[model samples]
Target: MVLYLQYNRGMTPTEAGQIMMLQAVMMTICAPIAGRLSDLWGSRVLATVGCLIIATGLGILVQVNDRMPLVVIAGSMMAIGLGHGLFSTPNNSTAIGTVAAAKLGIATATLNLARQCGQLLGTAVLSLLIAIFFDGRSITPQGYKDFQSVAVWALSISLAFSLMAAWFSSRKG
Candidate 1:
């Protein structure tokens, strides 16, 4: 959406590129810190907090509009990057650490496979939602609005799931 809007406004790709770069930089900076923190604090707390942060970013993203500022978009991206950085390492460590040494390879493979499958499924679902919202219309302002509505709905659902994950993570084991 940002790319589309930026293109329409005759802005160069530099702005979009910068936003992406910012996200990458944030992830790079936060990942190791989060990993260390997770080691100190435990995976449950870090992962739950990460999920909540991601949910917050997505919730903010639902409000994206043509009138929205670039700073807001960049900030949202940074939040998402930070959240993922904080979530992934600890979650993986927790999963792998919980299993027996003999099952380590299997556990690692299963974790990676699940991650890929989730990504694929999420992409497909979001794509379907976008198509449904488009309703075969060209990309107009109204179409963009419709897409935004679908995005909001999708993000809201994701947020609910994230909250659920957080809750589950918080439970006594």
Candidate 2:
């Protein structure tokens, strides 16, 4: 989104950064509330709902083009942030809760490992998609279409994965 704001919309970096801050702000505001809710209600439902919301945000992103409104982008970013805020602490709590007291350290390590692996995998996938389209070039005005195509393709794949996570989250042991 910052890239789109800068290259496609001709905005300055500061403006792009400011707009993207909405996502972080939303996440910061949501995490504690979600943690409290998870403690009271259980993580399962909140986690599932969070993944669904992330998928919805990605669904909106899949339709993005150069001409799309910044408001739409901001909203999508906020949805994603809100989703992560709702999902992360609960998921961590649930995972950590499953381990014995003596194994808490191992559980935390394993959780961090899983998160690192997921991040690496997601980055690699997005890089591959960008490479296929951008071919090591910068985003020229003419190449925004290619960038948009890659973004749509990648976000669609992400949306699918989020939906799958929701399904898995909703399941019982």
Candidate 3:
């Protein structure tokens, strides 16, 4: 969110709005298909593939600067969105399956807490980096390039983590 604002600083609000809208469309279109594929093929393959694709997408996204190229941005967004689609259901299923029905509430709470903590940590770290590097500038072509690069780095790390998770999930009975 902060990256989006900083990187696109020079753009009109309408342009920024359009980019966000495009992101929404891309996610909506790809998510369900990815989820369904995961259901059919198994999470191990889907999650691993999804993580790799998403990392590639983030790589592409980081390279885009100046005008928000719809093609590249949309493509990257779709890739990550599809990955989330693939990972979410199966990952949740595995976690849920690990607990008894009686303890499901506690399991879900723990999962939710972990997710929230991750989100908070990511947001804080990224926002701080963007502020320090960009000097609190609004989204400009150069700013976007810089922010996107960092975002890509973050995504790559996430993909590695996802791969590890998939590996562990596969080992379960």
Model 1 ranges with Cα > 4 A deviation:
1-14, 140-142
Query: What lDDT tens digits, residue by residue, belong to model 2 across residues 1-173?
Result: 67767877788999999888988988899999999999999999999999999999989988988778889999999999999899888998999999999999999999999999999998899889888998899778889878778778888889999999999999933
For model 2, what is the alpha-carbon lDDT of residue 127? 85
Write down the TM-score for model 3. Answer: 0.70
In order, what lDDT does every prediction score?
0.76, 0.88, 0.64
**Model 1 agreement with the true structure over 49-160: per-residue lDDT tens digits:** 8878877877787777667787887898899788778877888888899999999999999999999998887778787887787867776755656766766777676777
Counting clashing residue pairs in each candidate, in order, gives 0, 0, 5
Off by over 4 Å in 3: 1-9, 21-40, 134-173
* TM-score order of candidates, top first: 2, 1, 3
Candidate 3 lDDT over residue span 99-122, tens digit each = 999999999999999989989987
Cα deviation in Å at residue 140, candidate 2?
2.3
Clashing pairs in 1: none
- For the record, the alpha-carbon RMSD of candidate 2 to the native fold, in angstroms, is 1.5
Off by over 4 Å in 2: none
lDDT of 1: 0.76
Ranking by lDDT: 2, 1, 3
